[model samples]
Target chain A: MTTSPTERNGWSGDGALTDMAASVPKAARKTSRLAGPASTAEQWPEFEAVAQPQLQGAAVRRLAGRRSNNGVGSSNSSSSANIGNNPSKRRWPRVVLIVAAALVVVALLLVAFAACSISRGESSFEGLMANAVIETGANAVSYDEGKTVYYNGHTYVLNEDMVSVLVIGIDRKESAAEDKPVQADAVIVVALDKKTGQATAISIPRDSMVEIGRYADGGYAGVETAQLCLSYGYGDGYETSCEYTTTAVSRTLYNMPINYYFTMDQAGIGPMNDAIGGVTLTPLQTIPKTQIVEGQETTLLGTDAYNYLRWRDKTVLTSSLDRQDRQIQYVKAFAKKTLGAAKSDPGLALSLYNQVSSYSITNMGMDEFSYLASVVMGGNITGLDVISLPGEMVQGEKYAEFYLDKTAVYETILDVYYTQVD
Target chain B: MTSEQPPTTSNPDPKVPVVRKYRRTIAALTVLLVVLLLSASGGIGWLIWEHNQREKAAQELAETPIPTVEQPVASTPDTPEVALPDNPIDFASIQQTSPDVYAWIYIPGTPINYPVVQHPNDDFFYIDHNPERNYAFEGSIFTEMANSLDFSDPITVIYGHNMHDETMFSTLHYFEDADFFAENDEMIIYTPGHILTYRIISAYQYDNRHILNSYDFSNPEVLADYQEYVRNPDSLLVNTRDVPLTSTDKIVQLSTCMTVQNWNRYLVNGVLIDDHLTN
Candidate 1:
């Protein structure tokens, strides 16, 4: 069994044969360990088979008493085995790293998609809600009903186009005995021209004398003439007040048939003001007094504007005409602010429309409201034309009674409403 | 024993070879870290720049001023002034003139001297025609020769539109109640020959019909009815103690359209009390 000197020299001539023989045994043993626990002891036998040649050569060298080269070679061989085994053990971490990286990317993409959808939805919802509210609220009133009335022996149709719509603001008290709502402290008429998109605004003093619908006692016959038409409307129904007041006013001077009507209580005005941001109008004078009436003061910026329109009983103002002037100022200021805001801020308009929808009632439908707003936005009517019926034109009782200036009123109406536009 | 010993003559080698590998692994990790950091920094810088641009545009729009209507452009004068009487009553000289003849109205206490041109068409006089001239400024006043204060009879009703600019009869709106009217009760109207001071007596809104028919210049009963109606004791601005109107008291009515339709016309009626001829 001992190797000859010639055979030994042959083994030394090529080291690949020795290295392969060493690796084959270790590879077979590792594979057997991975396969199962059953042939564990047999693995050593297989390993020994592969290592026998190299071991035999080493033993031959050892017999010759050489140690350092064998030690280093064995160390190198073992290290190579360790490096090879490391990649298999590291496999799990590599798979974990790849999966984690893929998950992070997917999560980021999901967040981005969610954010974009939310932003788009918010803007779209805002616009849709605004349009809905405006349309719904504006449909409450009828803007197109035509009523015919006689004035100065001539009959005229009071259509939305030719008639004046008086918006009355009434200050109501919680405790005050609820007679019909209090007299209109403030009155403004928007005389619209359907054909031309032109409108005239008239502010009436509450103290103006005019024939009102007959109330219980304060009257001559069935006629009660006074400036406070709201008192009549409140005491009587809208139709009766319209007839008595319109008839009296028509007979007095150049009055025209009445058209649309809007009544806003004090509570309604506040929200409308807030919805439109605020009305901006020039004040006629620096009002020293804060409160126009007891418990009613123009402290806030919005309320202050309201006060100018509502102030009716103070001696500081020489006459009702002065109050009328203040009312006109408020109208112009409100118109400018409302129209301007609608043009610039769509979100703000939506918010305002929503707010106004809750409190305001208008006869105009969605189409008419949109049309009216568009006309104003188009800049057709920039300046407001204000006029009043002449005193000499009206006739009635001294205190609360009054009449109309028929000629002047008709002429004014014709000029404002009927004149053909080129 | 001799045979077994002969079969086990060769011995096996046990030393193992080890190789250390560091260059490739270190290089891969370093490259991945650098790529992640670079991507994060670039994304953050882009977002900050977009936010600043939107803020700058909003501030500039808030500072612009609104333009006014009725500003007078260069144009020839419309209404020719009639020659004054030989006595030549000099109310203050015309402060400014409008290109159109529409009318010239003067009030002593306020700054309302402007050309009164018809609004839209030449049918009704409105102050909107001349922008340089505002009839509602303080110290400007308006007077119409045709209107009187007492609503009793066929009266010439002078009208002035109330304006937000405080130019025309804007101040008049303050007089509807008692206190505001008391503070500014007396306003003098200056015609070419006579300076007339009017005492504000009554202020109220009348039915539109009443305003239309009350201007019958020929009927005395109509004027009487107008006067009686305004003299009500319960008036918010006027009390019974105010003297009854006499023939000497000519009326001046200042009027403006109310925002309200058909309900009423905002009316300010004043009686002419003192007259002075200024030459």
Candidate 2:
């Protein structure tokens, strides 16, 4: 082939043709290889059909030769093949364009797929509600069931979007005897409405009589109506105790759902109190038995907050109730200070939660804490109302029993949980 | 045996012939690139159109006026049941759209106003079908055959999609906020001749267990246990009231999907607190 080009062009030597082939700038060589012959239109088809495959083969060999040269700096005989590989370079950009376009299509598909998945999940939600008419042998009300309850000639619905949690203050610490059952010193049901920023705490005196399941050796014993504090004594003094107490409170409070329990021993009060600097308030009453003086303005530190909560005169039958009033006062002040600090420092709530965790056991997770914190902080809550359950402390044979007023319980449940439906 | 290259120093022929030879191949490659380029843009356009369709459906439903039930004449005072005020609603128009639609639900302070339907044959038919019975991404608010159309069951569970567009029950998440739950506590369900108002008791995340299938509401003990679970759910994200839920109390549980956890559903439970006779 090299000799034929020299003879046809009337060149004197074969070296001249090789030099000319090599000297054709790489871009020109791309076309020159295919340009040979075809001076006449009649020969063009014949030349193209036979030349396409050979040109492709030459391009492929040239690439291999170039790669080898880079790797081993080897001298190869395929130098002439390299001159015809300009077409490969011209096609590189097109290949990249196709790939980029395909990627764009794929990315759009992924986004659309994500959006459809959300709708798909929502549409796939299946519900379980049975229409089977089964007679439960109970008298049916004359009006629409479940939607409205007629109470005292008034119709009311459960207030929308209300949240309630049971805050239990234990009488004993973790170091106490494992076998011995402990009492819940303070039982409070705190309800919060994030929208209204309205929060109320219903304090259940430890001695309130309620039905609680009695557990013996982790087995369920028969339920007994006893002082509410005794419910804590029925369990292993941890989760079981809280569960028992929650059931008792729920039953006593007209079966109100009291989820979210946070049980803390008496020892947690100090660290909790000190976490927000300290709680300052005027003493509500004089307690001669302890350092808490009546009608005196005081800022309580760690142990001071502990004394304000723990000291109850054993002589008086109503001493626990009196202590409860002061405990409510202290809690209100402490919470006010803590939440106020939390408004400025978002981490304050978590830090306070962590500080009390050593002496506390709770079903609340970090999400719950953050949820409540955000609610309390973002809500327009003026202050938390500390309410004492209206009850009469009666002298029993050996211990004092606080019997909650049924009407009061009903009224409280209505005021806190129900909205008038007119 | 054909090729001869001209000397680089004195090249006589022009390059135009070479370019002319490959013109058809270049044209084919150009066509392919254009097709690929068009497909990429077309894919994006299809997605936008799909999203617009979903939004259009939602917007149409939102624009539909909630029909009001006309109040009947004075009833017996001894009955302790009062008649509601006349709110004229062309319920006939609503029924015309779908005979399956039996009730209307309205929650103030949230975008939950919509007609409630029950597919007689398939419990899940309305899940992906609109009130017009057309296929829609945002399904209609529906109930299964497990519940009566009159809302008389001890527990009536209503199902809706938690659409990302916040058109369906997605706004139910408002109740997750304490302030929203407290301020907006009542929801109204209007049947043919009666207006029912339910008191929102609690808004909490619950397991995806079918309430009707999981418990026999016909059994008083089972109903009591289920009611207890409703009042005192084990979920961490919860907002509850001090309201009591008894086995005799007829409650409506609005169920939707949770955003974070697919296996769990967010429930806004309401107990029947008010019922008014309407024409």
Candidate 3:
């Protein structure tokens, strides 16, 4: 009561002002006219000059509007009218902009993370009937996503989801340059059904006479009937070579689409053998150039793996046919070991892929490979059926040629790549 | 129970200083924001600059002048074989660039035409170092200390980086293709007085274990086993020729790293096919 009117309202008074405000040349007094007991009109002019630099345009204007209406001290009516123009009015837009910017940053990070997770230089192969299905016949019945046909009294549908990989064993020796065309010594088409967890491998002998596209000077010349293995020699020796072999095989097997190709040269046998921690098998035949006795169980390791897969008596014309039988046996054992190892250590397949990548070429992406590996690792696959093409080997000109049984090829393709509609 | 009421929303102290109260905190926050922004930008900028510099250096090194082979004089049935002229590569001039240059290797159908250098002191000095003795990720083609300079070793393992730009030994992958491996076979190494030609027998991926360190080449049994492995590598990705390899044959192995597996190496195995004297 003893203090002046200016001092009572905390203007130019040390007792009323905080230490922070007292430190400034001219302090900004925060006044809520509606909430406070009373703030005089005389105090506002000084407040405007000192706080104008810090206050937003809207806040400053609101304060200025209040000063004009204020005439009497403790004017409740004037303060009540200005309450709608509080600091929160300006804060809404700023909070919205901040939230929008935060969301944009989060979206960008998510996109970048997804991009990084995808494997580089790997592409998923699109199946031929990925979207469109072939018309079977008037007696066609649709089953799920597949088209069905009445085949020999059984309603069969093309299992479009079956993942087929063509496995080729090349027969080019280290000293193999003089040979005119490289041969696919052992050719096997491995197909797996993810839904049923069933796997089937069909081994086609190298000498099977099939239609092969001919190329001279890297350009397609014409299609000629040649031994099935010679199809691999027409391309650039990597992807193109693999493609030619796949196409030849597809044509040979009722034109069923093959999703992938895996080729192993004679060199990859030993490391691949050790990768599965050595495959133990009783030799079906006495393998030449090695001490492996027929009907004796031997754990093939290092160079022994090479000899077991590659040994053939060149003098015998049907030596290749004999060799194919041995290869089929080896493959069955190898697959069993690989699937078993993968079950215990899920990373075994990818690690093996990486190890053999130098010695092998594959079109499989990491995602597709992992998915296939996971299916195998899930312990869902209990049995693998390997079938050799029913054919007769006849010595043709200089090499042995195997003429495939057409009816058998047709039925095998249906059995391996098709599902029962019922 | 004794209770105290919370402060009401109305009548907040009107005398409180708004701007002066948070000035120190505001200044500190602004400084932290600026520092974070600058360092993030600086790190990204440095990475981009380094990548650009590496590319530029690779381009400059690839333009180095290399010697081309002189076509041999045609031989009639009466003559033994085509008579090759004197060595075209000036060993004297190449030695001037670096005395460590002992031989130049050229593979037909591949860009692997470069001088082979062996550091007198450090075995890996040329692995990440260019021929000009500058730091380069695309290092010069080199051989280790275990082999002889005369190309007389039973097995010589030459090493190079599989550069992303497909320089150095990257083109060696062309042999992985069955067709390319069949069509192309010869790899020539030209020393000061001798032109040694090797017939490529096999090209495939092998484990990363040091070949020289793992095996004793002097042992005939080991050489036989190795030759057999080379002839019949169990890898699915192999290209082999019909040429035969024996303990009497000298072989050269061109080695490079695989893209995915650091623990594996791609090897192009070759056996000595011919040796011609050059002035």
Candidate 4:
């Protein structure tokens, strides 16, 4: 089983020594004998001198290791030559190299996977709005109005373009029901031109004189002509009050027909604000009445902005007209913030739409409203003109009266409503 | 070789000593080689498995999708069949479900589709809960929950509720940082066809009631005075470029409640830039 030393080191009896010796230069052939076993001091110099050249040459050759040769060798040239002929030993290094390469490939793939997972978790505006809509229960309103309003012996079909909308701000403090009739704190008249997509808004002062629409119910029938419009009616029936009020106001002030109405109460504001995140508003002066109200507390995500708006008494407002102007300020502020927020986050916009739809009573259907939304969203309209009704106190024998300045109101409306666009 | 030796017990296997030494050396070398080979193979295998895991994780990460940023539209289409009339207001088309609970505001630049909830109890809109039955789009605008349009005082304060989705005035922070405001200065507001363009004169974030007297908008003189105060250089987010504001100017004030402090208000001041009709 065991071969002689010569056979073990080399494949043949001649081994690789004879061949290596022959390959050496003739002058260096003497160095071969010097490599022989001779442990003696006197022979050391001779052996070193002769063997130095051959040893140096062998070292250089070994340093230039080629991957194909596997570079497995010893100082003994015979043994190296014999081992180099064996193909099985050479294949060992190739297996190791292949395994290393496979490991590298696997590592790269895992890295790629981890990177993808991290990127997917980021959230955006549109998604947030979608979630918000689900959270705030707002639905689309249908646009089917069974009847049309007759104006000047001509029936006016209820459409988005040629509609007059009355935007009412109601003060609903006592009743918890969403449909309860609340007193109107603010009133705005909006007329839309369907063909042009142009709108005219006229702010109606709360103190203006007008005959309340006679209702079968005792609540609004006897209300004073000067009281706010919402102090008299509720729900679908409120349309009559809007019709009568629109007629009287139009005749008494702008001499125009009123068509549509939109009413909002206290319950719906929070979600709308939450939907857009929040709106930014700049005040003309500093308001100091910052008391926390009942049922309203500050949270990490929610803050009480209503108290700031309600801080009227402490703000040194000189007149009711001043308060009306402040209301306009709030509206403009809301407009800028909401529009800007919607641009970045569609989900928030959708959420706000959903929330508002729930508590609102509007004549516009979902489809018609979407068209209007597209126009507003697509075009820029930050410079819209806003005008308020003119009013003055009238001295009477029995009661002090506030009368609407008909000429001023009409002039303001005409200017806003009759603009030519190029 | 045939020398006569002392008669001692002689064993036939006399070469056993040399054979035993050689065998021991060979066995030790074999053991070392085998152990080295086993360890190397195991090391390579572990490295390969680890690398594969990492690659898989990276691949999964690459496959994830990022959310889109824009306004949302109604799933249904808006066509002429559902259109409202051209003249006289259509009361029936615009339903008032909760009178005073919510109202619809149409701004030309806004993506609001449905009626927005009117938060009478609070001055601003709630970003979390949707006002039931209202147009609860993600970024629908909300007005001051309780502020009035009183122009009699020095400043008329209006407040809007901000949302995390950046729907309302979440972008208002862009103004708080100086560089952002420089690029954006104009916005358009639409009420039906009444278009109003506003110019951002200055923007500032303040603690709630920092300038207490400026919220009154009733007095024209007071309003002018409040504008001056807001234009002061010391304000947190204001530009003191001497932007002129007058009583004749119909200014728009936008306010939002912030979580910075319990009562802190973040206000964005803008002036009426211009007004024009689209159609």
Candidate 5:
């Protein structure tokens, strides 16, 4: 209530009084726009000091008229008559209004509460829909907002766009033969980045000493370090075996989440090769020219495709490591040719999937299948990046064990972690 | 109420009685306003209570325990070789009260524990019918007539209302967060002999189309093309797996209405990765 010098002097000087009068009207106009009881009373004292000498009655009537016009009127005539004249009048109507307003505000708040509760009852999906439906019209919502495990004290949230797949080439002729026992000859951890359209395969040689998980019932039985490929033998040739194999590979890489697993027996290869139309591989090693010889880009179809992938001559293809490189070449070629054809025809990639699905047992359903197809069909068949898990070829009793180089394995995973593809 | 009457035979200006009559009218109007305000508050309170009841019912049903039967082969066996739980859901007991209850769908991370229904002839039968078979605004989760009741289709498109209250398939929107979609890729559908597991591949807002009626699944070209289409979905803001899809795959689509630009349908898709049959 501290008065400015100009407002204080207005009681005496004529010009000052005129200036005060002008400001008072502006104040009164402002008072009408604001709510609450104290505002109207605050404006009256200045008005009374200047005008009460002659214009008291007119001011009172004007006050009543404006109050009614603003819709904050009361039916009490006594309060209306006394409004501009009395600075401290005990009015019951004001009390009534305050109570009514408080009630209204409470009701409104409750109504809002009920609305939120109702929306909370809707599923998160419906909320998104309702938000879009309602907010889109207003154009107001800002949308901001995994097998994942913590390794070495750092948490790596499993990337939704990233997936690790265990591709097991069961040592059987053709793909559908899972009834009898078979060994997983070729074990490769294929990692794909759908975002950058890049694929990397880290081949796990059969002899790496790693913990292979076994499942007793639906539970993880235990982990045993043996020849990396023997984990496949722990399960009785059904869903159990696939589960165990997936775990073995996942654990080998510090428990990376394996999103899906696919077991392809020998039977699946020919159809798969044909499914992708045909795959052409550049020779990583020469088979010493026997017609379709060494250092040549081999376009493989049917049985030849399988042979090129599984070939290992001590004099030519040489070792299991050599065979793995051929497999990687086959995969990269298959992806490039299939994905390339998909750009023009669109159905070629899916057709390939359908053609080969019968021989393979995988954990990928339609949605997973769709996303895979979608990423591949993304055009631009650049080049495939393949790396074999670095290891030492140690001489074992019967066969040699490719002792995994721990440092190299970690570096490869980090490469996948930080590497970005265009 | 004030009883102000007019003058019978006034010898004066007649303004006095008129004033009294106006005061009476004002009094009557004030009384009417109070009643209206009270009634409106009461109505809103009732709506809140009703919504809570529906949620309570849904919770009760989900928590109702698969009611000990001859035990559908123990769920978690001591060893991997032991038989996994595979028994048909007791549809007979569920249908005794509501014939609509058929299969049940459960997702661990999201709020998606509910009974699913199938109408043999009508696609929209359960769009307005509750699990209790009552005509409620929040409908039950239902698949269209275009899909086989056995869920044998390569793509079984299921539908449910997008209620403002999270009653039906509305929770499917939980997949909007790519992490939720990735961490919880498994979708379990309990059927007669098999417990089918589907990995969620893509979750995004899609155009409103009668999927089963629109696409000819029998055509390898159509099937193949659709697989690719879902891969590069129109608006995949959240998530997608980099898995390769072939036409030989089996997919089940969970479809619901989305209110967005042009108000279309939002779809969460899953592919059948593995199936464990029961004894």
Candidate 6:
């Protein structure tokens, strides 16, 4: 095929041809490859399909080839085929980029999955397991009964896992000498059941006759059966005093072991009560007004509370046992308040612990304090059974004394300290 | 047959499979690197968190007020007073928190100062429970309910886990060394009204036995015979100090798991040399 000279010259002239050539530059027209044939109009669509990216360059070269005045439609059609199927086409780069992005997304998903699986549960504190409870009795006997109990003889025998705490409020007006036994004003034993959160608080009257190991001038003078409260007077310091008091209480209570003891003086008692923001008292009976009112809902500050605790108005409620009832009520309320306060601010227990350091003494460690605080906060405190040894008030050589109802006290302790489970 | 000499500057044509192999190798390396990087970061982060938690607990314990439970009086009647922890806490309040608090056991040289509680009827519960009364792998130091709470028994055995972290009875192993037993021999047991002191006399490895359950300590003859056995123990027993073992001297045994056998336990025996009533 060939193009007529007139036709080729006219299409390739400096003057624009028909409509398409008008936009073409003079240099482009001279170099145009499409100029090889007058049939370019018929093949224009095919060339445009593959030459879009190098449109201007390919168009100029195509036109220039035909500008030689030769007709070649077959050649132009074949050129478009090769360019369309070329592997180096810009399309390959887009495919490569897509593959890289997909790889990155998959890696990120793997990382996320690993992270989710590796994260630990919020409640999982492995250290707590070492410092706390060991789940036992599950594989041992009495699976139906809780771990803290053993079913024996139709009654759940509490493992003498019994934690008996003796609480003492000392009546020493001045610093006691090493050998002087200062009597405790109030003595109470709070026994807790390890299995069930039952607490039995038994208060011993001051005048009950029980053998207390006497400490004389830095030496123990064997056992002397004296007023129960006089046990505190056997030792000059806190240790001896507390020990004798504890021993006396133990002896009076059927020799039940007292696990730990706490002694507080008037100063410590008041501050400790106030530390928990004062305890509210509601008197059940009418009495004379003093630092704390008798019948109304009166809040006692530390000092006022202390005065109320030790107040033994001989005229009204002549027995010291009457003072015990008041002490029991005050202790319960104070414990509740302290626990509630500690729940909000655990530091409160520590602060109170420090406050009582100088004037008070106890065998309890902070580990014990923290555990008690948690138990109180957890509301496990149940069976706040408060009782005193059933006794008769009698006259002594100098002061009035109370004779403990021994059989009754024994029965009460057995009931309060142990419960039957079938 | 189809090929003429290729360009000298170029090498052989890479097959489709070969190109694919190179791409796979690069991806695998990238994946491995990412995993390693993540593991290093996560592991280091966890370690820091754990250390911080332990530090906080140690600080709190150090500051926990130590009551003047141990009297300042020296060992002898006329000896000078020594500095002692004097802060006392209300045990009733503590029992409120943890009913497990049965007694406070303290040994001066080791981390044995802790609240001891008997497992409810189960001598083995402390093998799993912590001081918080929670099931833990490193259990708390505990005693069986068979023992008298007043320390009146001829033989009372306390148990703890042999944790590698040197917690609980793990430190009790120090008694196996004769010098450790001699230098730090005193073991103080505190109750509501008493400060009882014991001197470490013997330590050795022993097998598991329901000790108090196995024998009756109530009989005077049985109690006397057992004291003889403890005084003249097996060849493995290391006797650090010799004090006359009488029927009256109550002995407290500290036991922990031993590595020699699963059923083997290391025991430290202390004789009640002094039973003083400290208020």
lDDT of 1 at A40: 41
Per-model B-chain TM-score: 0.49, 0.81, 0.80, 0.49, 0.75, 0.69
| lDDT for position A248 in model 6 | 64
- Each prediction's DockQ against the real complex: 0.02, 0.02, 0.01, 0.01, 0.02, 0.02
Native interface contact recovery, all models: 0.03, 0.00, 0.00, 0.00, 0.04, 0.00
Proportion of the native interface contacts kept in model 5? 0.04
List model 1 lDDT by residue over B119-170, tens digit each: 3232222222232243311211222323332223334354444432334544
**Position B206, candidate 6: lDDT:** 45
Q: Compute the lDDT of residue B237 as modeled in candidate 3.
A: 45
In model 1 chain A, where is the ten-residue run with the lowest total lDDT? A20-29
Report the C-alpha lDDT of model 4 over A1-422, residue by residue, as the tens digit: 11111211001111112111110111111111123222331232211113333443454344233222322221122122232345533444454355334433433433434343222222211111111111211321111111122223443332323445567665455333555655555677765554454555677766566644333332222223554454335323343444444434443432233434566654566666566665555454444444333333332112344433333552232334555676566555666676666565533444555578667655544433444444445555443345677777554454334577655763554455433221
Candidate 6 error regions (>4 Å): A1-156, A174-181, A284-291, A314-317, A382-384, B1-279
| TM-score of every model versus the real structure | 0.33, 0.44, 0.44, 0.32, 0.40, 0.39
Candidate lDDT scores, in order, read 0.41, 0.65, 0.65, 0.41, 0.57, 0.56
Which residue segments of model 4 deviate by more than 4 Å?
A1-162, A174-181, A193-200, A216-224, A230-255, A285-288, A291-303, A308-319, A344-350, A393-401, A419-422, B1-279
RMSD vs true structure, all candidates: 38.2, 25.7, 26.8, 36.1, 27.8, 33.5
| Better candidate by TM-score, 4 or 6 | 6
> Stretches of candidate 2 above 4 Å error?
A1-147, A173-180, A288-290, B1-279
- Model 3, residue B227: displacement in angstroms? 52
Candidate 2 lDDT tens digits, B68-153: 55456677877566655653444688788788889989887776788889988776567678888987667789888878889999
Clashes of 6: 58
In model 6, what lDDT does residue B78 have? 68
Model 3 stretches astray by more than 4 angstroms: A1-146, A171-179, B1-279
Locate the minimum summed-lDDT window of 10 residues in model 6 chain B.
Answer: B1-10
Candidate 1 C-alpha error for residue B154, in Å? 26
